[model samples]
Target: MELLQSADLYRRAADRIPGGVHSNTRARAPHPIYFERADGAFLYDADGNRYLDFVLGNGAIILGHGHPKVQAAVQAVLSQGLTTGSETRLGVEAAERLLQQVPTAEMVRFANSGTEAVMHALELARSATGRTRVAKAEGAYHGWDSAMYVSAWPDLAKAGSADAPAPVLTHQGADAEISRRTLVLPFNDVAATRRLIEEHAQELAAVVVEPVMMDIGYIEATREYIDELRALTSRYGIVFIFDELLTGFRVAPGGAQEYYGVTPDLSTFGKAIANGYPVAAVAGRREFMEQARPGGPCAWVGTFNAHAVSMAAMCATLQTFEGGGVWRTLQERMSYLEERFAQRAAERGVQVTLRGRGGNFHWYFTDADVRDYRSAATSSAERYRKFAENAAARGIWLAAGTLSHHSLTIQHEEDHLDAFVGCL
Candidate 1:
């Protein structure tokens, strides 16, 4: 696949834009592939290279790129005009749908991005509990906000002990006081988490966690860990926030809370909610979410909180999942891909471990059990990076850098699975 045109565009973009990309994740080692257009399960580059897109807009496009339903919804909004700066009937309808679908959603508020949703959730938690500290899993990424960004991708040297990890800030300008208020705990270590939570219970407002740790290659939380955390938070009067940005609609109709049978006090959702449209939400118990009201302690206001186009797309995406068969298909496809790839790796004498559930999985070129961030970090990322680059060269677009999660969409078929596994 020729990337000459993409390369030229990258050079031009670098002259004006930092690192030639808006998001740091888009900055490939050599150069990023500039896409001209996207269709169902495929991305067409500026150089006219047609590649099967596993990135799927970083797992945002659940129904796949340019789905007719989502496109029609967006078109309808366009024809009606992009209404913002105020609430619309469309937004109300979308919230009602979310409340109906999400198991923990009694009251809902919209945001333009997952980060903002998480921020709002944190603020509500702090307000409700009158606490100053928050705790999150060491490798779990809620968002890039200063309060939750610490220890997301901490360097091993500075990460401190596994049981009591230090909060290592990712960015330079992140507030030190916010980092100080944030406590880092190991994922899947129930005892350690309990001890930490108990130690800081008086000051801890919320304990935020991802049901499946996405930033650490989709390492799932054990049933015991999630259950204990839920019980402990309730017992201690601390808010339990589930960061479901990556797992919301992809895992189940109601998300991780439904999948795991444990509901959180508050939940932040995005990514698959709108099927690539920029929309996110904070939903939870009514009493907690009420903190965001005008007279409430926490302030929640946004100019484009529920942009009509995004609301339409979200409603359309929810409609597609009404039959409950969408998740089943995605699970079957992901399992098939996992099996085929494992077989291919065995044939080539390559050691690989596939971990995760639903439509998302990670390829770690090691047999070690990836239970936590440290174990996942120790895996052979160099080998996986090389594999991803080779796959991209051969028309499969896996996101570059780290052992990232690969996902399938409703549009993926057996042929795409065969092709992907065959590439390995």
Candidate 2:
């Protein structure tokens, strides 16, 4: 309950680290708690208080924290060296494993982070299609790439219209000029998206979206929307890019594309793909992927792109997923958690609007069903902040906002599930 040690550490951390964290999102308040270690579904803080972690490294650790398979794989490559300038069989095997699971990907190349994956994917789209403009969903989180970052969690005030969104940068010092190259689309709006895509079909290089959106409170794409979007992009010779950084492997073995029975032209994979390791991938059909090869279209250059350790971790995680047991368990556990969440909300007479499938979820603190940023913006952030503060006191670490999404791991045992319901 007491974060006294963490409070003191934050004071020191704030003086040195910008915002007391490496990534701005780690600044989880009411005061950031420093972690000493993590195992299974629990995190041991600097103050030695153990918390049932629902964040799970922002939905990357699908196999759970410090998982034995991932650990041993990482450790095996540790003695082999951190990274080699050239290629490894492990990297080749990792991509093979990924392609086996994902039906959309005929070929793939590794990267270090989700942003890098998205950036390269966008570049491929532009180069392959010979178009300059890109389109993305209004509320989706596709990492922090300048072109893709537009309209991701934009302030509604500046976010123009719900049906036809204007590009609003999520960060300061973001290239204002990039806004001219980026276009925004509404979530779950098949008609509006079709209209916009057709309107800019000539200039549109790609339509980047998340099948299961996480940043805007986990809004999912309707089947109709996804199917129509794919058709529209194909009709116009534009690339259909799915940013599955948070959804890949976790939503299903083949990800949202497999889950929704849709295939995209190109997609970015990370997060759960490495089970918390620093690895990502841009994968697609042969023609598009080959463009990154040699003398094709785009330039592919990154010294540490295929770190052996991370690739091994990815291989181990994906191999484990190949058995298909973990995904079934994830569905069962997520369903139970949803039931408990709703039960407790009903008990307290709280009006909670929930949206989730598989392991990803969020409980919007409002009565309205939310589909996009404009509708989701109505949720009460203030109430969620207080709830987060109280949950932290009781050894539960929820993500900072009501609208922010969280995930479950296979490691969350019955006790963890019960405690989660109790916290609710």
Candidate 3:
């Protein structure tokens, strides 16, 4: 197969950077695309090719790329200085604003990335609970850190039984002793979760979960399931953390906690919060969050937390969403796009499964419904690879996976959705 100039750039990048990318998750066999820039819903490649950007910075661009409001905010901050290291006026304003927006949050702490935020949250949980064990869903990914990186992407054969999946270490030289502290459980199984939590309650510090499983094709928790988790965690006095890095601003202004009506003790926000800038935060009840500091036992220190530019970007992004009626617009566009995609797939005799909500959807080829990471893993990567290649050729961009995520913007119109349908 012939490769695009963008793909060639990725090959060159791989030779220098490990896997030709900073993150292994973005790398694939044919290589990734090298984008020159982006504006609105379009990405300009190094080859001067413009493609409709469904990836949307991997669901970070909720306000779309180069939003005028966000740009102006960043420019204003830049006119002064970009590095304030959590002491800037902008950082203060952003943190206060975030606390106002997040219902479960009485206090807020910032970090440079989702991974950093999650890592800190875990520490705070452990300190608050005085426990060492952390529990996560078998396939859910929190970050690259040793504690939470236990079973992100597991080999099917070595992953053990579906009922109680084995936690496989992804990193080299990772201490087996540390990995043993994390317990993996099947997602969406209330009974299984109850069993595990009950079994490990005394030793468990926290149970981290994504309200909407974003990377695994946006499978949502049934209200009953979430309620069960909350009750069980409350009973056990374990911190229930909602990793809303992908679902926070994208799902709703209040994030999944408000949408699901199940409030986690601690929540992490990222991706859409800064509309592509590298900013993340951990917010929760005042009592729990106070554990991370001079006021509490946990030492959650990061020099780069809430840098001036990122803080300005976050405040600006949230302000834009306040006026943009983002959730309503996303609902309308997603409903239309999903309907068209499903209709076209039906006509084409494609055996693909459509999952997720609003702008964030996953296209999968699976015989059974995907509820957790294991089921999501069995998705048809081969077909998605072909679909991505075809979509890229047709001037549409999508990630190659049995699941893909999207960001909604005004630039993505009916015509674009129709063209995507036509391609299918």
Candidate 4:
């Protein structure tokens, strides 16, 4: 597939924009493929080449690009106007729908992005517990905020021990004090996590985890591990936070909590919640969430918190999920694609393991069962990059990087899967 127009645009963009792309992830090795339009499961590039999109806006497009329901809702909201800076009926309805869907969401507050939701959640956690330190699993990305931006993808040589990982800063100028207050733990290791929690129980304000670690390719915590963490945090009076920004509303209606039968003290949700709308939320027990303004210690205020258009989009997105069989169809499609990809890899004598559940998955170019960040870090980055580039050349758009997970949507059909496998 030729991307001459995309190349020309990228060159012009580089002269003005810092990296030739708004997001660093969109800048591929050679040049990014610029999409003119997207519909269903396909992206039409500036050069007029149609490619199957497995990236799906990094797992945000659950119902797929431009779903009729979401579009109609957004259009209706647009007719009314945008960003009133006051509470709207649509916002209340959206909150009610969220409370009905998520098991842990007794109260909800909206934010503009997942990063903001996570920051608010952490602040609430600290205020509620009156503690200074926060604990997070290595290779788990809560957000790019200073408090949680440590050890997301630390170099193995400097990441300390497998059981107790060191807090390595992910970016320059990350707050040294915040990094000092953050504790890094290994995912899916029950005993190690328990020990770390106990050791830092007094100072630890919260324990944040991605139910499925998307940064490390959707590696999920074992059932026993998740259960034990829940129990331990409860016993120690630490705020247990599930960062479901990637997993929520995608794995199930109530997200990984419902799917795994483990409810957290608090949860942060985004990505697929609004099916591509720029909205995120922090939900938890009323006692904890009430701390967000009007009545409590934590200050959670955003001008665009529950923008009318996003609220309408969210309500419509939830309506689609409520219509039944949505998740079932997505699961079946994902399973079929996984099986076909594995078969093709085996036939080609390639050593790779596909990990994850429901509509999300990762292809690691290794045979090992990836359970934790340490184990997952060993996958071949160069080989995965080359594979993504080659697949893109053949009209299959995988996630740009090795650590990222590719996702399927309700828009993805058998033909897209066949085209992907044919490329393989």
Candidate 5:
């Protein structure tokens, strides 16, 4: 657990990388452990230390690491050729598979990441509707883009009032114009969202949101809340968009849209789509997506869009999910973990809370149920952080923060859950 080699690697990486890691999420306390390799539900650090990986690459590794099918697919594609700019048979297969699986995706276009996909979907909505303003749910992490980056992790002072939250720029270079063009609304507040949309109906282009708010403790939207948005958007002629970057293939094969029984005009998908590969997709009605008109004004083009290797991996991964009963097994595992955590907390005279369903969820060291971002913010960050550090030390790896989700790769074994809960 000392992880000497990991410490050395981090020290060297810090000298060159901005945070000693490529992404902020990976740069947690005690230095980010340098991973040597991963296979099936476990990760080996630079010190050769093994861990039962609940993080599962932040819910992207649905079937676990080094999945034979995905690995073989990538290797087969690489053995022949690896290129991003050219159209290939694997790309066609990936798109067909995605369109078949995703509920609202009649046609699909590819991008490099969730940020790009979300940006493209927003632009498409605006172009189709001829509107400029876009509304996004508060505390959602679409990506590091200007449109959705506003109010991602706002500080306490400038976060504004809870009901009508002001969009605070997390980065320095963000221009004031982006905030002016964007409207921020609280999640799960169906009435508030309806009022906001009606107020901005004429100028609004789209209402983009995550069906399941994973970044803030995996909070789920009520059925009434989802129905309200869908009805309002349709009545107002506003585009509805579900940003399923995190929940795409993790929650259900058809994504949250299918699970929640709500349909959006447009949707953006990523993360587990390509099994952690740097790939994402924007899909929707033909008319809506036509704004990116092949010969028209708006253009959503990228060099690495639907790269061969990523396509192969995605196709292979999707095939695996459809053929195998992965989600069923995952649902059962999460249920057991939730019950065990609750029992352990009660026994220890400590209060622990669990939220979300199926493969993704959050564990909080509080008695109250967290319904939204504001509610989640009041939880014991100090205790959760300490628990994460201890869990990682005890050969269990999870998302390194107070708020995060569980991947389906977690062990369903009773003793493992008992040991984990008892440890706390």
Candidate 6:
């Protein structure tokens, strides 16, 4: 239970880095565990302890750590040099495979991160619609840019009515123009969303959302809500964007749009597509995607955009996902885990609910149905934090964030899962 090496490394890191960790999500209370390496579904920390990795690189390592296919693809491209600042065959294959899988995406462009993908998607929406404002779900984590950084995890005290929630900015002191332009809509409320969209129809260029709000718990948008958004956006000529950063390939082969049978003008993807490779994409219908062309209204240029190595890795991951069995397998395994957790919680007389789709999941401390951000937030944060702490003590590395959801890799076998349950 001693994180001696991890503690020492963190002490040094804190001297140089603002936080001992790179990502804000990794800024755990005492210290973040620094892992030496990961193999399959196990993470070996600097303290030399092996733990079943439920974090799954924040849902990015769908095939698991050090997947042979992805590793081989990456290795194959290393000899060809990293970035040529020109096009290559691997890049073409990656884009073609993405468009083929996502039927709604007639064309696609690549980026290095989910945040950049979301930013570019919104810019494309604005250029195509010639509008200034955009609307997003109240608690969804689209990105961290000024425009998309509002209302992700706002204090309920300041958040306005459920009918028309205010856009609460994440940063304290900053320009307020971004907040003023961003509109917040109550997630999972079709009537309220419709009213806001209609009222601001002319000025609203885009309506961005996560089909499943995985950050706050695996809270899903009702089918009726999605249907309503599509209808409203179509009527108003507003660009609809699905920010599938966490849910893209994990939720289904195509994503939430494919799973729900809904279509959006644009969608952003990252995480699972490349199986841990640093690559993200903005995909959508030709009318919208074409705006990013050479002299078009939207600009799209990047030195490492679809660098050959990452594209090669993405192509291999997509090839593995070509057969429909991966999705089915992920669903079956997660459902089994949910069943076990439910039985265990019942035996302990604990009120809880497990929610997920694809392979992502979360267990709330409350038994009531968690259909949206507010209900999910009401779950016992203290209990969840304690559970994560206990799980870490028992050699199961769950995410340290209070409301963060967890996901398993495809490589996690029955024995690994049973060990998790045994620890619980």
| Model 5: how far residue 214 lies from native, Å | 0.4
* TM-score per candidate: 0.98, 0.96, 0.94, 0.97, 0.95, 0.97
* Pairs of residues clashing in candidate 6: none
Model 2 clashes, total count:
0
lDDT of 4 by residue, 178-230 (tens): 98679998899888898999998999889999988987797878899899989
Question: What tens digits encode model 1's per-residue C-alpha lDDT throughout 1-424?
Answer: 6679989999899999999999989988689878889999999989888999888887898888999998998898889875788778889989988988895678999998888999999999989999978999987778778989898878989999999999998888888788867989888999998999999898899999999887667788889999999999999999999999998877777889998999899999988889999999999999999998898789988888899989999999888888778888898888888888889998988887776566877777777788898888877877877787678767888877576777889799989888877665
How well does candidate 1 score on lDDT at residue 378?
76
Q: Candidate 5 at 250: error in angstroms?
A: 2.8
How much does each candidate deviate from the true structure in C-alpha RMSD? Answer: 1.2, 1.5, 2.1, 1.4, 1.8, 1.3
What ranges in model 6 sit over 4 Å off?
none
Off by over 4 Å in 5: 410-419
Which lDDT value does model 6 have at 355? 71
* Model 1 per-residue lDDT at 377: 84
> Which residues of candidate 2, in runs, are more than 4 Å off?
none
Model 5, TM vs. native: 0.95
Clashing pairs in 4: none
For candidate 6, give the lDDT: 0.87
CA lDDT of 82 in candidate 3? 54
lDDT of each: 0.86, 0.85, 0.81, 0.86, 0.81, 0.87
Better model by TM-score, 1 or 2?
1
Candidate 5 local accuracy as lDDT?
A: 0.81
- Model 1 lDDT, full chain set: 0.86
Higher-ranked by TM-score: 2 or 6: 6
Clashes of 5: 0
The pairs that clash in candidate 3 are 14-20
